[model samples]
Target: MISAPPPRPRDTTFGRSTPDAMQLSPDIPTVELTSLLGGGREAVILHNGERYRLRVTANDKLILTK
Candidate 1:
């Protein structure tokens, strides 16, 4: 009988953090939180070496800009 090929491994990085997240680790994305708290506003996060800015909106979502 024919056999099916082995299944591929799934990517577990869906909710995982990226390099920027690592650098901005520990901190709760100051700007993001600020904007979120400010209500319907946008905030920009800053860090070093990692080269990126974290943007958070009133929606309470974190987006890393490289």
Candidate 2:
């Protein structure tokens, strides 16, 4: 029987962060997801008086919706 090929590993680097090339700007504040979500899968963000829902999908990707 024919079988499917093995799945390739997901690239979490987002095509930017690399060893020796990784540099974060001090101007922008960094916040960890753990601290932001407080160990939850979702968090609500308030921006410009609008409410947005930010949640992690089943595939472990993030999604934001109004």
Candidate 3:
């Protein structure tokens, strides 16, 4: 009898995993926009100790400024 190999671990933090689709590398993480803004029009993000502002425009577009 032949033994099957162990299953590979998957990361679902980005969203649901598609069994038939190729998965992305775990090194890169993805986050939803709604989760970041929390139902608000603006959000502040800190990168390399610098502050950046992210806002939603009246046209429903996104703008990011440092």
Which candidate number has the best TM-score?
2
For residues 1-66, what per-residue lDDT tens digits would candidate 1 score against the true structure?
A: 999999999866555556453445575754435544365344444566556656664664667777
- Once fitted onto the true fold, the runs of candidate 1 whose alpha carbons sit more than 4 angstroms away are 1-5, 9-37, 49-51, 56-61
Per-residue accuracy of model 3 over 1-66 as CA lDDT, tens digit each: 999999988764543345435466878777878999999999999999999999989987789999
Better of 2 and 3 by lDDT: 3
User: For every model shown, what is its TM-score relative to the native structure?
Assistant: 0.28, 0.62, 0.55
**lDDT values for all models:** 0.57, 0.82, 0.83
lDDT of 2 at 16: 49
The true-versus-predicted C-alpha distance at residue 4 of model 2, in Å, is 32
Better of 1 and 3 by lDDT: 3
Q: For candidate 2, lDDT tens digit of each residue in 4-59? A: 99999986667543543546677978787888689999999999999999998898
Best lDDT among the predictions, by candidate number:
3
Q: At residue 42, what lDDT does model 3 achieve? A: 92
Which pairs in model 1 have colliding backbones? none
RMSD of each: 7.9, 7.5, 11.7
Best of the two (1, 3) by TM-score:
3
Instruction: Count clashing pairs, candidate 1.
Output: 0
